[model samples]
Target: MDGQENEEHANRGEDVPATDRAPRPAPRRDGAGRTGRRALRRTGVILAVLAVALVGVVLGVLAGGRVSTDIGPFQADLSVAPAFGGGTKVDIPPLGALLLDSHDGPTHLTVELGALDQSRTEALLDDPASINRASQSAVDDVREGVLRLGLRTLASAVLVTLLLALLVFRDTRRAAWAGALALVVTAGSLGTAAATIRPEAIEEPRYEGLLVNAPAIVGDARRIANDYTRYAEQLQRIVGNVSQLYTTVSSLPVYEPAPGTTRVLHVSDMHLNPTGWQLIRTVVEQFGIDVVIDTGDITDWGSEPEASYVGSIGLLKKPYVYIRGNHDSGRTAAAVARQPNAIVLSNTTTTVAGLTIAGIGDPRFTPDKNTSPAGSGLTQQTADQLIGVGDQLATTVRSSPRPVNIALVHDPASAGPLSGTCPLVLAGHTHDRQVSKLPEVPGKGPTQLMVQGSTGGAGLRGLEGEKPTPLTMTVLYFDKDKLLQAYDDITVGGTGQAQVNLERHVVEDPQAGVPAPVTPTPTR
Candidate 1:
């Protein structure tokens, strides 16, 4: 019965062998795989979009117009050329208008950086491979920013080409044309940036070029630009101080001299201080000075390098009568002689402002050829020569048609012999001022020695030590008869920028023997 049942089931096909039955179709796997592929496509599109946006921004920056910004005291304008292999140029317009006319006119300076170095170009591009991680982190940041921007631009180009091919053109030929045009634009911008911009543009200047050629042109323009900025700052500071000084002086009480009297400005021991020129010019114009007397030490070492400063005195537009001090060399005297308005006196007499002036320069050369530090002290030989010169000058004055009204010398020691020869004696070299009336010379009138203090406080040396002497200048007023009547002393405390004090000292008639009048107390 079992055999008969098995035969019947086999015959029915439901009982067919398992191996002979066809295998059921494999389950569908398109769902997860298709999902993954769609996710990848979305990610690529997003990346492409970001890249395209980055490229646009970068191209705009590169092809944009020039940039301008202020760096400290300077206004700088920078222009980058668009063409490959071209250069970048920086222009600094003339600052004359802002300089208070310190210069003759507006001066423009242009700096052009030719084709940039490869390394520098790479740095500007922010190529991480070219940057060193050990040196500075800023370089790394720059590189990262550049790379990120560039990658996004490339990705965008790819995505746009794909979109054009599938959505717009739906053709390979159109997609290729669109992709090529986008690449060309991006390449052009990058190429221009690489050619023009350089690392030197942003680097700190060395200023080494300043030592070689300065106040005019420079090999390294960036260094000069930096120096110019600093100079502008210093100039502004100096101008402010000078303006303040003028305002202060104008507010002080005026010292009116006798009518039709001659006024003389006495300046001494400038010691190469440029500020002295400014002060002297101011005093000459303000006082209506008829003559200028400089009892020298005009230069610090009296070297050939310092001779040029002598020309500045001629700017006073007054009769500049000069006598050499221990610090002045023959070169310095020669320079003084070149000035049209300068009168160099060496045991000679010249009439100025209707008064006979006799002067004898210090005879000894103070600068030793072999000394490490230049010598400035008066030597015995010079002292002896000074004495002889003084005697000769006194004799010459006595025999002249007009008696010497004023006697000028550098050292007070040399001024002793001129006492009886002239009523007024002016000298400098002590860096300290003094007023003294010599004993009556039996037959001649009594002589008054007015020694001026250092006009520049010994120049830069004044600021070296713990205590520095004050800068001083004197103005002498003459009576209608050309006789000394009164004088005003101007003193500036400290060096560089300082406060000015004016003191007026009167000279009473010697015959009356009355005490000299006290200086009027300053109101401010």
Candidate 2:
């Protein structure tokens, strides 16, 4: 009984000890909860600041007075400042620089920028890929830089607005509200002011100040830009007409001298007419021409700028033989040499398509200088100088092992001195088509002197007059033996009009046995 009692006592003792354990302290308020609340407040403050900054940036960009970028080849200056109400203004100086300075007097022209749609403007601002694919990255960089500048300006405005609000309101919450309200009001005012200004359907950006002294063509700049597409289409049509004309000439009986005769297309006095290229290309392809002979006056002034005009001749795939005229400057020869197919002849003979061709350039650099004898034709002084040049070339042609088959010159006076040296003598300064059998020289076959008319209808000079001169070109046929067989003369109406008339003349009938080859002799 005592042992059992002792066991119960031990159990009771342990239970008593457990009851003495201290009550768990009331659950301590979690410190993390306070920390979480504090963290949330900080996050809200940061977000609010970021939102305000974002708003300020956006507002600043919209209200920015002007944004400009110096894009390559052009300066894109956009003015958002209140102007003529609230319309945006874009000014580009380089846009007006494309005009050619081919006119006289002070030229004034205006172009409407609104002629382009919004999409075009956006494309131009963003990438300018349509105008030049290589400038896309540069354009994008410029746009971004302008936006960044606006952002910086907005940041400064926001800072100032916040300071002002704090000073006036004297309370943080009130200051924030005041600042936001002021920004809203300012943006609203700008928007309203902008709305008052309406954009013109066609707004010609003011370019007079920029172009007043620019050395460029003095024409209506606006018209050139607007009519650019029309000009391009006209060029295409000209090329097509050339192809058709060739087909027509091929079908003509007189154009074909024999089964395998060498056909030569003579073109001269182009005077910078862009149409001449297409015309030459078409004739070469259609007639299967063996060679092209240009007697000179390819350009009027033969200035450096006119060098680009000579590039058109490169389009012809056939061998092109050329000689400079009085109007063609020395620079013209340099440009002609750059052409892949051009062969510049200077008192030299070259064999082309089995025909010996010799040529001499004109002596005078400018044709206007010799106007003293314009009424009665070339003066004896000018004629003697031309004859001297012909004599010099005649010596070269007469000395060549291969008899010179054709002689090319620019002035008619030069043609007379080489009458018996070649069977066919070509000249073009007269700008009048003349084909005459030269008086037979004692011991030499009669030579046919052919003068080609102005291929460009006197070019831009013709526009100065009441009527433009007619465009003319000639096609000369040669037999297998390289003797002049027959020829066809083609004439077309003046600029802006297309009226082609062709006349065929038989120089030497093929059926009427080939005349003895002209014995080459030196001109006295």
Best-performing candidate as measured by TM-score? 2
The reply for model 1, stretches above 4 Å from the true place, is: 1-243, 368-382, 510-515, 521-524
Q: How does residue 175 of candidate 1 score in lDDT? A: 55
Across residues 177-293, which tens digit of lDDT does each residue of candidate 2 receive? 646654564455444543343333232333333233222333554675577666545544544444444344444333556777888999998887766665677667766787999
Q: What is the C-alpha lDDT of each candidate?
A: 0.64, 0.64
How would you encode candidate 1's per-residue C-alpha lDDT over 1-524 as one tens digit per residue?
Answer: 35566567678865755555556999999999999999999787555544543444344434432344322222334333233333322321211111111111111112322232545533423432322332245445435544444445444544554454445446565555556655665555544454444565433322221122222232345665568656445444544555555565555555698688899999998877776787788788877889999998887667665676787877878999999988888888999989999999988899998988988887666642221111256466666766676677778778878878888888777766676887888888778888877566778777887789988787766766667667789888888788777778887665435477888877787332222766854632
Worst 10 residues of 1 by lDDT: 94-103
Clashing pairs in 1: 48-155, 48-156, 51-152, 51-153, 52-156
RMSD of 2: 18.4
Which pairs, if any, clash in model 2?
Answer: 86-197, 100-217, 101-216, 101-217
The TM-scores, one per candidate, come to: 0.54, 0.55
